[model samples]
Target: MVTVKLLKPYYIKTDEQTVRVVLAYQYFTLLINQRVFQFIPIEEKEIRVSRENGKIENIHDRFAFQNGKTVIYMSLVELISAPNFLNHLHSIAQPYIQSEETKSVTLKEETEQIIKVLEERNLKRMIDQALDERNKVLFDQLVKLL
Candidate 1:
């Protein structure tokens, strides 16, 4: 069973709108639903949900998991549809959870490795672009983190 939990919630404001984004710390295991894992949302593919009359509704008609092969996605839906969903989610998410006392530790080292790989890909792209533009200032700033 996989356990999913929100790490923290934050807001980003673009010129057009302010949006809320939630990041789950243990996101890599979610890929069991299939498809490549991505830290960033694809353009025109973000799910928008809102609270209405004390219930959450999808603001848009897009289905978040139209072609996903993972079981947790359905488990998540079941969790949202019924009152007892937390228990169901708990069962699936238990393994992925860390002790509250040791919040800094990740339950699965592999998930951390996958996150590093994804971050490395983005960093490599930025590094390449910086080199092409001859921007040593930005390249040095990025490489230090890498």
Candidate 2:
């Protein structure tokens, strides 16, 4: 089983058609078995969402992210079926979805606060697991993200 968590939303960019949200820092993490894969986009971490309902679209079904030398390709279709993903996405996108601005600067502080809180929580959880398993390298790396 895989568990998915969406950690942050950078900001929302509303256009005539596409609404882009540049998820900042380590945007999300995918946990498979006891191992965690934290996704930090070096280039593009694109998620196409429906402007109508805010649910993630299937058009761009696959996304790739790198950690050290390992590159992982994840499917949005799989994520959409993941437990609690829709709810998390809805919560992150709700305010921006309702906003009328092309790009909302108003949520900067709020977004940062959300990111910090989530990042710390995520790191702490992973850190504890690492510590319990005596995985020093993974613990050290996760701590650096803090």
Candidate 3:
């Protein structure tokens, strides 16, 4: 399940009139750690038009991170429908899409490496917690002795 955290909502004045702009940041940290996809961190910008009177205008921008750098991997302007938006996403992610090339030693192959790193980090956290518990127990024993 993807969880979307809404940062804020505001209005932007455009050429015609004021349009509602919803700003949000979505991170699939858990899913990425689970090795679901290629796990490229993305910066997504979405603009939703008013349905009551104004016509819907689709504007989206996505930035993909690679080698500690960000690149504008995808962009769509004046997208009229949701399906179009999905199509745009597919086009942007086409390079990493499942194929023989992806199976080979490519950037897609690095996905497993990233997942392993995430798993190791999680293990470290678990070890830290165990150490903290053991320290607490030792402290309690010392207090009893006193």
Best by lDDT: 2
Off by over 4 Å in 3: 1-19, 27-48, 58-68, 78-146
Query: How many steric clashes between backbone atoms does each model show?
Result: 4, 0, 0
lDDT of 2 by residue, 15-53 (tens): 644556565557777675646767766545666566645
Global lDDT for candidate 1?
Answer: 0.41
- Give per-residue CA lDDT, model 1, range 1-146, as digits (tens): 22322222233222212222332323322232334322222222222222111122333322222223422223335435444434433343333334454443443566798989999999999999999999999999999989
- Highest TM-score: give the candidate number: 2
Predictions in order: lDDT: 0.41, 0.68, 0.40
> Candidate 2: which stretches are off by over 4 Å?
42-44, 66-68, 98-146
Report per-prediction Cα RMSD to one decimal.
Answer: 19.8, 24.8, 21.8
Q: Compute each candidate's TM-score over C-alphas.
A: 0.26, 0.53, 0.23
Stronger candidate by TM-score (1 vs 2): 2
Regions of model 1 farther than 4 Å from truth:
1-107
Residue-level lDDT of model 3, residues 1-146, one tens digit each, is 32111223332333333243433233211122222221243464444453223333445654232323423243334222323433333333333234455446667569889988887776666556656788776555544443
